[model samples]
Target: MDTGVEGRKASRVGVRVSAVSKTIKGNRVLDGVSASFPLARVSGIRGHNGSGKTMLLRAIAGLISIDEGSIEVFGEKLDARGDFPVGIGFMVEPLELWDEFTGLEMLTLLSSLRGRPRENHLRSALTRMGLDPDDLRRIKSFSLGMKQRLNLAQGLMDAPRLLLLDEPTNALDEDGQEAIRQVLIEERDRGTTIIVVSHDREELDRIADVQFIMGDGRIREV
Candidate 1:
């Protein structure tokens, strides 16, 4: 794959975690984590299970509050007591979907909650992910790969300025994985700030302009 943008760098920080820490059930899930995810680039995070990768993403997405330190998105400090970062599209792991709803129906419902994106836009998102928007099958009948693609389509449909994905290629085959890589590259080129969490080191290396390793609640660049 073409190495992201020709001259991309962390010159402008999109998401900044400043000495952030989080504790849960007497376990430190985040330990003074500080990192900068640059704008218009793909930032990758990889770690073993329970290594705080997801928790960090949660903090960035404002889904969870940090016990210590702070987080800023696009130069605005995030307030846990306030609203989430605007213009962000996040798809976390353990994909959740309305089993009884068809792909189109689900997208329509979600879009309604988010200002009702046009019907064509929703259909286009599904088609881009290789799903038939007119298909009548319910999500419960979809294969794991299909579900993963739907999850990605949900996050990408609106073309948000910031994209946060967790294990985006989970359950996808080789061809599906390649499609995801290309989509990420395209998003980066469009100046969308992306932070993706994956367990596959090789896959991250292929798409990420910068990569970080999370272990025992701490992170270091690699």
Candidate 2:
């Protein structure tokens, strides 16, 4: 597999939010946030509910309109800047997939949109995530943890250089959470930058290369 030339100036995009602030109606969500999520490191976003954790992730993902600020990904500036979804993957608001499809099926279908995916990639994702391949049962039949693993599998099928996950431990047991954490650490080790929004301070301590604690829609260095 061609890993591409390292350090080559190929329009590489890194997540950069500078002095970003967002307000909805009359409530402020993100207040003049400025941060840089570099390439190939895991950063944790922790905050109270409605503190703008998810909103911040969404803004970075280009899912919402930014009121004010600059968001750059893969090195491309976003918000009237240009396209920056080159190598970004995210899972939030529940892994949306065909509940009728198998885990592998979901991975292939979702990844194929990005490009060709290898059989080993999908299979390896399943194996590494501790999901039994034989559990080819419909996604609707899988438990929350199983579904979450499937979500991770699909997101990783693209081999994204930058991936963002929100509240990743939402529906997993201790073992399942550990497995997800292991995969995240491995991703970081393999030069994949990751940004995860989690409330589990301990979990963040385990995988985060840095931490940002959100308060009143603003991140305070902790």
- The reply for model 2, stretches above 4 Å from the true place, is 1-13, 80-84
Model 1, which residues run further than 4 Å from truth?
Answer: 1-5, 8-10
For model 1, the local distance difference test gives: 0.88
| Quality of model 2 by C-alpha lDDT | 0.78
Clashes of 2: 5
Q: Which candidate has the top score in TM-score?
A: 1
Candidate 2 matches the true fold with a TM-score of 0.86
Residue-level lDDT of model 1, residues 100-128, one tens digit each, is 99999998888888885778878988888
Clashing pairs in 1: none
Candidate 2, residues 1-222, lDDT tens digits: the string is 112354222323257788888889999998999887767777789987899999888888777877787887767787633243667778766657798988888887877876876777788878887776567689889888888877777667667788889888888899988888788878876889788998879888877776789989888656
Query: Per-prediction count of colliding residue pairs?
Result: 0, 5
